[model samples]
Target chain A: MKFNHACKLILKNLFLIFILTSGVHGNENVNDKVKKLTLELRCMTCQNQSIYDSDADFSIDIKKLVKQKFHEGKTESEIKKFLVERYGEYILFRPLINFKNLFLWLFPFTILAIVTVFLIFSARKK
Target chain B: MKRIIVISPLIILFIICLFTLFYIIGNKDPNKPPSALLNKNLPSFTSKSLFDNEIILTDNDLRNKKIIINFFASWCTPCKVEHPLFFELAEQYPDLYILGFNHKDAAKDAKNYLKDEGNPYTFVGVDKDGLIALDFGVFGLPETFLINEKGKIVYKYMGPLTDKIIKDEIQPRL
Candidate 1:
């Protein structure tokens, strides 16, 4: 009877440890997702820092909002679209690829291509 | 060939200089981000009145009238500086509807602030939770939006409402 009691206590301790460890891991996963999403969002109040980096009240509010939306099972794209609709494209650190911003997206590559072609033609001429 | 290359570079330099000059002179206050809601209809929201808890104000109340929506807080110093100007404007334009949104402020503080400063608002709404402010895309306090009779947002001023702003920008539009 004594041996049986000791085994039961040991098993209960192991079960509690396992549950605690698994709960911590689960929380870490959600925290990682929240951090990734917050990093992508600009702090509108600061205008210079990401929502994850800024300590502004507005940034805190935005972080809470992002986490709340995630809790509601919103996809990342859906969350981004919602913020974009409210705050406009200016809220995005990386400007959206669209008709108005097509040139902005393509301009650097276009310039690089032009420079490369010009250099190639010049080398051939030499 | 050498002359063409030299001349072309200089021409390009001059053109770049001209463009930079035009850009700098034409665009004043480059720090001010353009409001996304300009020309868009006001976002609908319902909030309790600051004065009377039973009274709720909505977007419907703002329609069919030339309205000025001012986002303010008791804690913001700029709002205090701009308070007298609002009172002056309120006195001047009795027909104009000015809605005061007490953003992210305590109800007691907001009421006390208004009492101290003299309430110039036609209808004051308390944005206690700031959800309404978020809907309006308000990043900071003391921003003002002018809505037309059609309920379209015509102009948004991001800073304090100075006398010059009232005389030049707002009065002309009104």
Candidate 2:
């Protein structure tokens, strides 16, 4: 009897957590989501302008695309992936953290680790 | 131990300097980065032909045949510079299909431009809203693509095509 109650409680808590997290994600206005995603995308026509900031034809089209994707119930990452596939990595301001770009992402941390090790070694010597 | 420690960062810096120098020395134009769609399949598209009111062109029409797709606008001045070259391309390779996409251009203006320039394209499609260019990841006006029999985009050029480019870059591929 006790085990059955415990199992029921765990299932109920899990369901609640899932609902809360999904609600938070879904409650954001579609326009706000579009703005946030477009901020990360580059305006291909204009030099050094994010899609959200640029009034270029390319930016406007991307904004329309993102809005459409959101309306189709696509997630942010899904939309980003679609954009990356369509336009290549140049369309993104932030490079993706994949095997090809793993070195780029970890290079700063590698430097930090080396500096820390060198500092510790010198301190010990002193 | 102290010498080795001091030399390590110097070694790393020297390696970095060498790589950076090699990259800078390579003939990479700062203005033009490489197109990302090289060797990729052309995006499937459908459009109404500029010449005919009822004719529609789709990706299926491009199957088992090599086609050169050129995106141009009547309003773009640079397109006029490359305008004459298509006639040459059409003349040289009679079997090769040349497609013209009149991007974001009015039907009347495109018809007038073609009439004035002497139409060389096998088919002219109307991309009235620039959506087709967006699909191709076109950065600016007057982009050209060479699609192979496999429907892969083998070569892409941004800006106007010159006689030299046609001889050196495009002819050898054909």
Candidate 3:
């Protein structure tokens, strides 16, 4: 009985050590991930300011939340999608190509098409 | 006749461009008119002064004081550039209470920043959470808000405050 109790105590201590060490290691990973992602997300309310730029209390809270989400094993895409869902694509200062934003997507091509047609017509006229 | 027609279009375009430039210049006054929030009371929120631990600043605390509230952060490069301008304002307006709301900074870093850079604020407060900034509708760093003695915000200026702002607009208004 005495030997068994001693073995159990040792196992508990080892388990505690593993938990503490892994918790710290996990926290560092989450912090790194959050910092990396934040550098990309623009603060929509602040023109030309990245999420990392303004020290607004909310931005810091978001940074902390991002770290927490990362620790939950969310992928970068998942994290970005979550922010978009909450704040809309406005949170991403860089506009993305989509059906709703089809004009934004189509604009360059539309301009090219117009230029090409004009060139062809002009050449034919000449 | 062809030259006259071509030259007229170019002159018209040049005039249009010149008119547009003047329009932009007129509208670009950093000290925005008080119309944004003429009679609105100040948004109530709480923050700790980055300079002193004992001083806790709240919206209610600003009542009956001509206050210049500046939002800034240690990491923001432009904030550093605008710091001198802020100092100039503080020096000029002794009665004007300059409050530095340090958003999203560790208290230690804020204290250190004050130590390194001359502390211009009458009180430096830490917006550790950023709730205060949101209440004031702060979307950017280095944004300054002018609040009247009654605690109503008279104007808000986005981006860095410049010498022209101090001399031409703010000083004249005061």
How would you encode candidate 2's per-residue C-alpha lDDT over B52-113 as one tens digit per residue? 86999999988988899999988989999998999999999998899999998889998999
RMSD of each: 3.6, 8.4, 9.3
DockQ of each candidate's interface versus the true one? 0.36, 0.28, 0.08
CA deviation > 4 Å runs, candidate 3:
A1-126, B1-39
Docking class of 2: acceptable
Highest-scoring model, DockQ? 1
lDDT per residue for candidate 1 within B66-169, as digits (tens), equals 99999999999999988899888888889899999999999899989998999999999989888888888888888999999999888889879999999988
Best by TM-score: 1
TM-score of 3: 0.51
Q: State residue A121's C-alpha deviation in candidate 1, in Å.
A: 2.3
Q: Rank by TM-score, highest first.
A: 1, 2, 3
Return the interface RMSD of model 2.
Answer: 2.2
lDDT of 2 by residue, A1-126 (tens): 999999999999999999998877665688899999999998877788899999987788889989989989999999998878767887889999899888768867876777787677778787
TM-scores (chain A) of the candidates: 0.79, 0.73, 0.68
Q: Which has the higher lDDT value, candidate number 1 or candidate number 3?
A: 1
